[model samples]
Structures are given as C-alpha cells and as structure tokens.
Target chain A: MREITYREALREALFEEMRRDDRVFLMGEEVGHYDGAYKVSQGLLAEFGERRVIDTPIAEAGFAGIGIGAAMTGLRPIVEFMSWNFSFVAFDQIISNASKTYSMSGGKIKVPIVFRGPNGAAAQVAAQHSHTVEAFYAHIPGLWVANPSTPRDAKGLLKAAIRMDDPVVFLEGETLYNLKGEVPDASEDEIIPFGKARIAREGKDCTLIAWGAPFHTALAVADRLAKEAGIECDVIDPRTLRPIDETAILESVAKTNRCVIVHETWPYGGPGAEMVDLIQREAFDYLDAPVLRVGSLDVPMPYAKNLESLVLPTPERIETAIRRVTYREER
Target chain B: MSEVKVERWLDDYREMLLIRRFEEESARAYAQGKIGGFLHLYIGQESIAVAAATTIEKGDLVFQTYRDHGTALALGMTPEAAMAELFGKDTGCSRGLGGSMHYFDVENGFYGGWGIVGGHLALAAGAAFRSKYLGEDQVTLCFFGEGATNIGGFHEAMSLAGLWKLPAVFICENNQYAMGTPLSRTSPLSDLSVKAAGYGMVGDRFEGYDVDVVREHLKKAIDRARSGEGPSFLEIETYRFRGHSMSDPGKYRTAEELEERKKKDPILLILGKLRDAGVDEAKIEAIEDEVEERIEAALKHADEAPFPEESLLYETVTVEKF
Candidate 1:
C-alpha cells in the first residue's frame, strides 16, 4: 500500500468510480479545464475527457438542480462546490430535490449523486468563506453526510458513497488535505459500507469521539494526555456522521464511563451536540460525569489570526475537555 | 408516430371533456375543502393538450408545470387514479406524496407536474439525453410557460439540449400573464420560442387555440426529433381559460378580448367540424354519454377511495437498500 494525501485520495476515488462506470461524471464551477479550484481534479481532464468532466458556468442553483435531474435519469454526477459556504447558493437543489427525490417520489427515483468538496473552515479564509455545515446538512433526513479525515478513509468512503443509491454530502476538511495515510489496495469488488467507525487509537481511561479536521486535533491531544497526564483516552473516528456508529460509540462510552466529543463547528447546534444527546440517552447510567464537548467558540469566526485561533478548537482545547470529562483536574 | 388519423377526433373530444369536467369538479372539490394545496385549471386551454398529444408516441415522455390535469387526462392517466391522487389517497400515483400540482405517473410517461417554474425543462432534456444514451428512437416534450423563458434554467436547458443535439421539443405555452405580472413586464422578448434560436435551435411559433396548427407543429417537431434531427422550440401563443389558479381577478385582459379568443375555441371548432363531416347526432350523443359515464365513474372512484394511510408521513424520508 502506498501513502497518499487526503485530497489526492479523493481525486483517485472519483477517477476510479468514473473509470468503472461511464455514467459517473463531474459538474462544477472549475471541475474541467481549471482542474478544480483546489487542484483535487488535477490531471483529470486528460484521463476522463471533457464530456465526463464538465466545467459548468457559475450558475450553482441551475446546474446543481440539473445535476439532480441527470442523476435521476441514470447519470451518477459528482458536483463540486469551491467551498461548503458556496453550497448555500445551491441549497435549494440539494435540500429540496437531491435529498428528497427518492422519498418524495415514494422511492420511485434513486439519485446516486454526490455534492462534495472542502467543507468547514479553509484556514485564514474568514467569515463569509469559513463555515462548517455538517449540522445543517445532517438535520436533513434523506441526505447522508460523510466527513473523512485521512486519505485512506477519504478514498474508501468516497467510493462507497458513489455506489450508494442515495444522495451524499462528502465533506473534506481544507486543513486535512496534506495528511498522509496508507490506502489499502483492495480487490476490485471491495465495498465499504456506511455507519462503521474506525478505531484510531485504543485505550481505557475515557473515550473521545471526533470527526473531520478536529479528529486530528483529538488524536494529538489523546496521545499527549496519555504520555504526560496518564490519561489513556480511546479515540474513535465516526467517519459517516448521518448513520453514526452507535454501537461503537455507546460501547466505548460504557467501558470508559467518560466521553469527550470534539468538532470544528461552533458549539451552538454543532454536530457534537447530537452525539452528546445520543450518548447520554444510550450510555447515561454508565457515565461517571456529564459528557464534555470541544467545539469552536459560539461566535462568528473572526478573520484576524489571534481571534481566529481563539475561536477554533485546538489540541490544547481537546486535551482540557478530556481532563474535565475524566475528572482529572489539570493541577 | 405518424400523423393522427381523423378518427382520433372522437378521442380528442373525449380527452377535452375529461380535462374540462375534472377541473370543474376540482374547483368544486377545492371549495368543499376536499383537496388541499395549489390547483390550476385548464378550462380555456383544453385544445392545447389534446392537439399536442396527437403527435406523441407511447415511448416519448412528457413533463408539465403546475397546470397539468389536462395533459394527464390526455395521456391516459386514468381520472380515477388522478382524482384519487388529488384527494391524497393511497391508490393515487406517487402514493399521495405528490398531491394535485405534484402528480408523478411514470407508467404514463409523465415525469411530474412540478410546482417550480422551469424545473422540468432540464429534466425533459435529461430524458432525451437518456434516450440517446440508450440508442432509443424517442423524444421528450417539456411544457412550460412564457414567464420561465428568461429564467436561468431555461437558457441552461436549451443550451445543453442544443449543444448535445438531443432529441427533445420545448412547448412554450405563452398564456399572456404569469400569475399577476403581465408577460410584457416578465419578459422583454414576449416571443419566447425565438430565444431558442440564439442557442442554434429552430423555433416555430403559432396560435395555441387552433388544434390543427398545434397538431401540425407538434407532429413536425416530433418527427424531426425521431429522425435524428435536433430539438425544436414550439411557442404556442395562447391565453388562460380561467384566472390563473382560481385566485386572480379577471381584470388582466378585457372580456371583449376573451370573447374574441373564445370565438376561435378549438373544442367548439372540432364539434363544428364533426357536424360538417357528417358525424350524425346519435354518434355525437353517444360520445358525450361515454365521456359522462367515464367522468361519473372517476368521481365515484375518487369518493370511494380512502385517504392515504397516516403512516406514509413517517415513511420515504430516506432511501433504503433494495
């Protein structure tokens, strides 16, 4: 198995899926000749040709909804948004049509489409551009949301998402693009199903569940606390957020009796709140203390370096939250 | 499909009667609070659907905007199933999920009766694209109003269809006003079909009230499409039979103007032709009675049909593995 970056893996996943299925194509602002604004679609024009890798005009709502129509008629299209913030322009298409097509048609239509790109903050890319929308998308019932942190998970999960008969919002953290990981060379027929969480690290003192870019922050903090503070926190990456790995989460919570959820979104209505609520109901009696959450501050993310750093969840913030949840005061 | 035979005149009358009676019954049902949500009647535009449908084959697909009862009735979506749907019954097509304005009947080649303006244009083009991809000799006809011609989706759909050389036809029913706004205010070029020419498409415009003209234009376009020629844009210039969707004042155009158009009414014209062609009184009476029987049976079926099971609200929110 060779090492690859998260963004590269995402590109490979798209190429492989398109290579395998002629019906799969790409439609977005710069998905064609410009090779994607983020370079994720680099060198794809030569591989798939222009017909499959379409460079659409900046008409987000029009093209996005058209993509939905195309998907219904047997084209599996992957639509790229420059950033998740721009998805608001195409929000009607994704929420009203793409997500609800199958259900509204009473399961008569299957929209095998993916609306994916760097979701969450794109570092230094302030207020208007820096936004995390997993909570907003996950709240919609028909859509499946997947936020993968590692290169391997990005590829595996993306391939799985493309093959799904439902619409998917595959989120990539702008900050985790360069993170390297081993992508297993699976057989041509391998299919990784949804709702399965991967154990990033094993421990017993407490359980820490994190996802997207913040999962790496949680990992860094977990290792630090284990070595210096004698806190062996088990780190779990709940890859697909919608159909969560409830079993693994509750089992870990039941064993450790403590849980700390970390996410990059603001604390109010962040995706972590749902996890905290769910874990409390399932593993409430087993808990030694209330669940602690590490999230960005509940304020619009500022543009300035210091203010931005203060608002975001960092490794230190996660480590502190874990200490609070585990009742090990950092004295 | 080749040209429609003269015998299909009876079939056209039957369909025209169904659309008229269905809309009339729908208005009564709405007043009685039996049907909820938006309802658009095709009272004045009966001939538009009947005339256009003569050119469509079983393999070709059709899509329409919110005012769709006439098209559905013409295409053989049994009024029983359609009426049951308007009542939100389980037996309705789409299982009561799509009421009145949102009818979806795949079996009858009806993609849907969408509420969103200009939404079906691209879907129809996509259907045409699929037919081409599958190497099928069929076409897709999308029906939208003059108001949507300037919308971005209209341009995008027309551009894509033209660029791809897809076998599709766009019917722009220029029915004067878009809800409350006049077509003059909504579009600079009130002639919406010619807008297709900018995208390298051939457009034909005509009076939608004349069934023969509408039938002639639709037949030529469908024939061109099936013979591997590209899409054609047909602008059927027309007027709404009623105030747009039962909620408008009759002040958009004067009664004199409405009377002038009514004088050229295709349904009346067809009946006149039947009489002139020696169709006797007994045959005409028999056709009318047959339509009445079918309508009464449909109304009975709708009334007898139960409301959709309440549990359906909690279902179909998420797609499942087959």
Candidate 2:
C-alpha cells in the first residue's frame, strides 16, 4: 500500500480507466491545458493527448448534454463540472437526458457516463459556489450518487463509476482533495462495489453515520467521545447515498440501540432526513432513543467566516447529537 | 423522362406520402383518445425528413424534437412500431416507456425523439464529437423547430459544434412558429441560418416544399460534415399544416393563411414532381393506395397491442440496480 492524495487517486483512476478503454475520454471546462480547475486533471492532456482529454468553453449544459449524447452512441465520457454548484445549469441534461435516456429508450440507450467534481462547502465560498447536490441527484432513480470520503475510496469508487453501465454523479469533497490516505498499488486494481457501508470505527455504544467531509468529522468526534466521555460510537460511512447500505446502518443501530446522522447538506428534506426515516422505520423497535440528525442549518450558506462555520454541521454539533442519542451527559 | 429520374421521383413520392398519411392517422388516434399526451404532427413538412433520410448513409445518426413521427418513419422505423408507440403499447419502439414525443430506433441510426426543444442539440454535438474522436466519418443530423433556436441549449450546442469542428448538421426546420408564436414575433432575423456566422459555421436556407431540393441541400451539408469540414446550420423553410399540437385550434393564423400555405404542401409538391417525370397515373395511384393500406394496418396493430406488464415498470431504470 502507498499513501497518496485524494486528487492523485482520482487522476490515477481516470488515467487507468482511459487506458483500459479507448472510448473513455475526459471533457470539461478546464480539464485540458488548464489541467482542471482543481488540478485533478493535471498532466492528463499531455498523457492522453488532446483527442481524449477535451477542453470546452464555459458551457455546463452543453457539455453535459454532449456527454450524455456521446454515451448514447457508445463513448464512455467522464464529464467534469468545475464544481457541483455549476451542475444546476446543466441539471436538465443530467436529469432529463442522462438519467432518463436509458429507461426512455427501453434499454436501447446506455448512458455510461460519469459527472464528477467537488461538492459541498469549501471554506467561505458562499451559497452559490457551495452546494451539496447529493440529495437532488440521489432522488433520481436512474442515477448513482457516490460520495467518497477518503483517497482509497475516491480511487476505487471512481473506477467503478466509470466502468458501470449507468450514469453516476461522483461527488468529491472540495476540502479533502489533498487529504492523504493509503491506496493499493497500480497492479492491484482495487474497485469498490456500490451499496456497501464502511464501518470507519467499530463500537457498541451508538451508531454515528456520515459521509464525505462529514465522515472525517464523525471519526474524530467518535475518538474524542470514547476518550473524554467513554461513549464508544460505531462510526459508519455509507459512501454511495442512492443505493444506500441499509443493512449496515440497521444492523449497527440494532446493536447500538441508537443513531445520529451527520451530513454537510441542509437539514430540510436532505439525505439526513432520508436516513432518519429509514432508521426509524426499519429499526424502530430496537431503538432506545429517536434517531436524530446533525446537518447544515436550513439556510443559504453565509459569506462571513464565523457565520459560514456555524451554518455547516461542526464537530461540536455532531458531538452534541451523539451524546443525546447515547444518553451521555456533558463533561 | 429518363428511367432513373422516374424511379427516383416514385421512391421520393412514396416516402413523403407515407409520412403524411401516418401523421394524419396519428391525429385521428389522438382524437379517439387512443394516443394520450401531446401529439405534434408533421403534416406539411414531410419532405424535410424524407429528404434527410435519403441524403444520409446507414451509420449517420439523426436527432429530432418532439414533432418526430416524420423523422422516425423516414429513418425506416416500421409503421407498426411508430403507431404502437403513439398508442402506448409494449410493442412500441421505446417499448411503451417513451410515448409519441420520445420515439427511438437506434438500429436505424435514429437516436431519439427528444421532447425538449433545444436540449437535444448538445447531445447531437456529443454524438458528432464521438465520431471525430474515433476518426469515424459518421455525420450527425440534428433537427429542431425554429422555437428551439432561441433557447440557450441551441447557442451552447452550436458554439461547441463550431469550435470542435464536429461532424454535425444542425437542421432548423423553421416551420414558421415555436408552438403558436410566429417567427416574426420570436426571432429578429427572418433568415435563422445567419445565426451560424456567429459560431463560425457555414449557413444555408432553402424551401422545404420540394423533396429534390431539400435532398440536394442536405446532401451538401452532410458531405461537408463527413469530410471533417465542421458543422453547418441549415434553415429549411417549411410549414406545418396541423396546429403545433392536437390541442391547438390554430386561431393565431387566419383560415386564408392556412389554405395559402397548404397550396405548397410538401406531399403534393413531390406528387406533382412524380407526374412531371412521366410516372404513370396507375403507378402514382397504386403508391397512394399502398400508403393508405399501410396506415390502416398500423392502426389495427396498435389497437390490438397490449399495454406493458406491471413488472416492466421496475425494469430498465438501470442496467443492474444495486
């Protein structure tokens, strides 16, 4: 195993997949020459050449639709949005064209494309540039939404997203691009399957669920709770939100007898709300407390540093929810 | 007349007549409540799609807007499949999932019957991108109404097609209106093809009433695309004899205006051309009779076809759902 940055992991996945299949090409605003806005596609233009590494003008809807169209005709395109915030302009292409084309054409058309980029808040980027779009995309039936929390998962999940015969929305963590984690060597070819949850930290006291940037927060909070309050939490990260690993969450909840979902998305009708409903409905009788959720405040992300920090689900809020669910008192 | 000219005229006339009669029966089916949802017929604009079909090769792809029955029929979709799709039967081209507005037959190089006005143009550019990337000579034909030309997707698609030098021919079938809004009210310029200059693409505009003229113009564009000369914008001036959809009464235009446009009907124009080429009266009448019989058979097949099974509802959402 070798430690690599999440950004490096993603680039490796793209490089490997494009090499494996000639049909695979990367197209986006700054993917080529610019080496991607986040530099995730650095050196891709030189390695894959201009034909495979395509650069387009600042037109999200156009390129997104083009990716869907290319997928329909037998090309596997990895269309990158500068950020998930920009995907709204291309929402129709992703929702209407990519998602529905497969079923609309009665399986005659297969949109084997991946729309990937950083999602959720990154520092003080404000409301428009910082959007956690997993809920909106996951709500669509024909789409797969994968939120990778680590460098290893980023590489494995991205590879799987590209190879799968369906449309995938790969939500990367803007803040986690440089996060270092262990990834298998190139010859290993590790690919993670969807609909599976990774128990980041195992415990029996309470089930603490989160994903993306929030997953790292949950892990840190779980470690702190065990040391300071003796509240050992079963920290879980269900990477893919759409075909969620219900069995893992319910199984952990059935043992722990309580749960608290933490996420960077808004509280109102978000993935956290869906998780709460699922946990309460499936594991209701086993619960000692109501399944609670700690999510971003139900308001537009603020521009000020202090207000922006408060709007997102901070470690303090997640710790409070864990204590409440576990019935542990403050120190 | 030369035997080759007569044969070409007869073939073109039969294809145009088939589309006209198919659309006419679709209107009847809509009125009878057999076909639910919006039915946008291509009654007077048959020559554009038929001519396009004649101009492209087997590997060339075609994309069209919601008013796509004509394109589907012209691209060799069986009458039964198109009619059954409108009727919402399991035997339909899209297997009852896609109604009239989403007819698809990929095997025949017809990608789809996209409902969104200009949303599909970018997809067409993408298809052309794939061809260019693979070094294939396949040309992509994207058809849309003049209404679609005003949308953002239209500009974005055109800009990309032009910038990338994609093998795409953007055919704007300016049938005078975007739904009920006339071109005079919607667009500033009467010649929509002039918009191509902004994207650095060549432009052409011609009457769509004559099948031969439509074919020749489309062939020129298609040939340029095949030769890697980049995309072209083609404004095929035509008129829809029917309203925008079945629900439209078309009171926006006067009865006299409608009659005046009908005088240049594409089907009639092709029929007259066939007669002038010395095609026998018996041959023309037999073609008309055959088209009539085909429509009747399609209607019967659609009427008898079964609705999709309930299990099919859960299928095709993804290739393999987790």
Candidate 3:
C-alpha cells in the first residue's frame, strides 16, 4: 500500500485503463497540453500521445454527444467536464442520448463512456460553477453515478466505471483531490464494485450516512460525538448513488435503530430525500427515531464566503442531525 | 439503354416506392390505433434516403432524425421490422422499445431513429471520430431536418466535426418545413449549407427530387469524408407531401402550394426517368405489385406480432444490471 493523493489515484486509473484498452481515450477541455483543469489528467497526454489524450474546445454538449456516439460505435471515451456544473449544457445529450440509447436501440447500442469531473462546491465558486449533480444524474435509469470519497475509492471506483458496459457519471470531490489516502499498489489492480457502501466507522448507537465531501465531515463529526458524548455512530459512505447499497444502509439502520444522512446537495428532492424514504420504508420498525437528513440549504449556492459556508452541510450541522437521530442533547 | 442504367433505375424506383408504401401503411395503422405515438412519414423526400443508400458502403454508418422510416428501409432494415417497431411489437427492430421515433438496426450500420432534432449530430460526429481514431475507412452520414440546424447541438457538433476533421457528412434534409415551421421563418439563410462556412467546412446544396443527382452529390461528400478530407454540409432541398406527423393537417400551406409542390414529386420524377430509359410499362407495374405485396406482408406480420414480454421492460435499461 502507498499513500497517494486522490488526484494521483484517479490519474493512475486513467493511465492503467487506457493502457489496458486502446479503445479508451480521454477527451475534454484542458485534458491534454494543459494537463486537465484539476491536473487529474497530468502526464496522460505525454504518455498516451495526442490521439488517446485529446483536448477539445470548451464545448461540453458537442464533446459529450460525441463521446456518446463514439461509445455507441465501439470506442470507450472518457469525457471530462471541467466541472459538473458545466454538464447542464450537455444535459440533453447525457440524459436523452447516452442514457436512453441502450434501451432505445433494444440493447444494440452500448455507451461504455465515463463523464467525470470535480463535482459540488469548491472554495467560493458560487452558483454557476458549483453544482452537486449526483441527484439529477442518479435519477436517470441507464446511468451509473459514482461519487468516490477517498483515494482508494477514487482509483477503484473510477477503474470500475471505465470498465463497466454502461454510461457512468463519475463525480470527484473538488476539495478531496489533494487529500492523501492509502491506495493499493498498481500490481494489485483493486477495482471497487458499485452498489456497495463502505462503513467508514462502525458503531451501533446511530448511523451517519454521507458521500463525497460530506463523507469526510461525517467522519470528523462521528469522532467528535464519540469523544465528547460517547454517542458512537456508524459512519457510512455510499460511493455509488444510482444502484445505491440499500442493503448496507438498511442493515446499518436496523442495527443502529436511527439514521441521519448528510450531503452537499440541496435538501429538496436530493439523493438524501431518497435515502430517507428508503430507510423509513425498509427499516421503519427498527427505528427508534425518524431518519433525519443534513443537506445543503435548498437555495442556490451563495457567493459570499460566510453565506457559502453556511449553505453547505458543515460538521456541526451533521453532528446536530446525528444527535437528534440518537436522542442526544446538543452540547 | 445499358443494362447497368436500367438496373440502377429499377433498384432506385423499387426502393423509393417501398418507402412510400411503408409510410402510407404506417399512416393507416396509426389511424386504426394499431401504432401509438407520433408517425413521421417520408413521402416527398424519398430521394435523399435512396441516394444515401446508394452512396455508402457496408461499414458506413447512417444517423437520422425522428422521420426515419425511409432511411431505415433504404439502409436495408426489413419492412417487417420497421412496421413491427411502429406497431410496438417484439419483432420490431428495437424489440418494441424504441417505437416510431427510434427504429435502430445496428447490423445494417443504421445507428438510430433519434427523436431529438439535432441531438444525434454529435453522436454521428463521435462515430466518425472513432473511425478516424482507429484509422478505419468508414464514413458517417448524419441526416437531420432543417430545424436541427438552428439548435445548439447542431452548431456544437458541426464545430467539432470541422475542428476534428472527422469523416462525417452532415446531410440537412431541408424539406421546407420543420414540423410546420417553414425554413423561411426558421433559418436566416435559404441555403442552409452556408452554415458550413462558419465551421470551416465545405458546403453543397442541391435539389433532392432526382435520385441520380442526389446520389452523385452524396457520393462526392462521402468520398471526401472517406479520403480524410473532413466533414461536409449538404443541404438537400426537398418537400414532405404529408404533414410533419400523423397529427398535422398541414393547414399552414394553401392547397395550391401543396398541389404545386406535388407536381415535382420524387417518385413521379423517377417514374418519368424510368419510362424514358425504355423500362417496360409491365416491368414497372410488376415492381409496384411486388412492393404492394411486401407492404401487405409487413402489415400482417406487424398485426400478428406480440407485444414484448414484461420482463424485457427491465432487461434493456442497462447492458449489465448491477
């Protein structure tokens, strides 16, 4: 095992997958020559050359649809959106063309493409640049939505997303790129399967479920609750949102008898709402308290530093939900 | 007349007539409540599809808009499969999932029956990108209506196709109206091919009334693409005799205008050419009789075909369910 940055881990996945399969190519703005907006595609252009590591104009819809078309004809394209916020421009292509092509063509078309980029708020990028698009993409049927929270998950899940014979929306945390964590050696080739939740920290008193940037916050809050109030929490990170590890969440809720979901997406009609519904419906009898959720405020992300910080789910906000679900008094 | 000329003329005539008969039967099926959803007929514009079929090779790919039955048939999709798809049956090209707007037959290199006007253009470019990337000599033919030329997807796809030098031929079948909005009202220029200059691509415009003329133009574009000369924008001027869909009465145009346009019907134009080529009257009648029988068989097959099993509903959503 080697400690590596999440960005490095993702790059390794691309490098490995591209080497393994010639059909796999990386195409996006600044991916080549500029080495990617976030540098996740650094060194790829030099190693893979211009043909494999392509750079395109700032046309998301064009490249996205092109990626879908390429996938349909037998090339695995990794289309990078500089940020998930920009995917809206290509929403019709991703939703209508990529997602439905398989079923619409009666399984004759397979869009083995990966649309990946930094997702959710990064610094004070504000409304237009900051969008947590997992809920919107996950709601679609023919897509696999993977939001990896750790370096290991980043490398493994990305490898799996690239290899899968379906369209995948790979959401990387904007702030988590530089976060260091242990990743399996290259020879090991660890590929994490989707629809499996990782129990970051296990306990029985309460369950705190989160993903992406919010997963790190949940871990910190869980540590704090255990140290200060002895309120042990089972921290769970659902890396994939679409096929979602319902069993893991239900079993954790059944054991803990309480649940609290935290995420950077908006509260209204978010993946958190879906999780709440799933928990209440499947593990209703086991619950000692109603499953609560701590999500970003339902308003558009604000530009001001203070308001922006308050808009996203913070550690304090997550802890409050945890305490409420476990019936612990706020400190 | 040379045998080759007669053979090509006869093949073109039969193909166009087959499409016409298929579309007419589809309209009847829709009226009888056998085919649900929208049914877009390719009546007056058979020359473009027939020309496309004549130009491309086996590996060449064809993409089309919602009004795709003609292109599907021209690309070798059996009438039974196309009719069954419209009828929403298991025997359909897309196994009853795609319906009228999504008749897909990948085996024939017919990529789709895309419903979105301009959305499939990018995908078409992408397919061409794959060909160029792999050094494969396959050309991609993207057929879209004039309405699609105005959308963001159209510009984006065109820009990429030009920038990448992809082997794609963007065929804009400007059949006057985009679902009843005439090109005069929608497009800034009457010659939609002029849009290609903005993207640094070559432009060609021609009347789509004669299959031979349309095929010759299409062949030049497809040959250029195959030779790695990049994409070309072809604005094929044509007309749709039927409404945009089954629901449209085409009340926007006057009876006189419709009648005037009908006089230049592609089928009639080709029929006249066939007669001038000394093709026998009995031979033409036999082809018509054969097309009628095929259309009748397609209708009967579609009528008897079963709806898809409920389990198929969950199957095709994703290739491998997780």
Instruction: Tell me the TM-score of each prediction against the true structure.
Output: 0.91, 0.99, 0.99
Per residue, candidate 2 scores C-alpha lDDT tens digits across B152-252 of 99999999999999999999998997888999999889889899999999999999998889999999999999998999999999999889999999989
Better of 1 and 3 by lDDT: 3
- lDDT tens readout by residue for model 2, A1-331: 7899999999999999988999999999889998999999999999899999999899999999999999999999999999999999999999989999988887789999999999989989888988898989989999999999999999999999999999999999999999999999989999999999999999999999999998898899999989988899999999899899999999999999989999998878888888888988998899999888898898998999999999888999999988887878577
lDDT of 3 at A145: 94
lDDT of 2: 0.92
For model 2, the superposed segments whose C-alpha errors exceed 4 Å read none
| Local error of candidate 1 at residue A33 (angstroms) | 3.5
TM-score of chain B of each: 0.94, 0.98, 0.99
Worst 10 residues of 1 chain B by lDDT: B1-10
Clashing pairs in 2: none
- Cα lDDT of model 1 by residue, B119-170, tens digit: 6687787778767766788788889988778776787788878777789998
- Tell me the lDDT of model 3 at B259: 96
- Per-residue lDDT for B84-201 in model 3, tens only? 9999999999999999999899889899899987899999999999999999999999999989989999999999999999999999998888888888899779888889999989
Query: Which candidate order results from sorting by TM-score in descending order?
Result: 3, 2, 1
Residue pairs that clash (backbone atoms under 3 angstroms), model 1: B44-B241
The local lDDT score (0 to 100) that residue A184 gets in candidate 1 is: 71
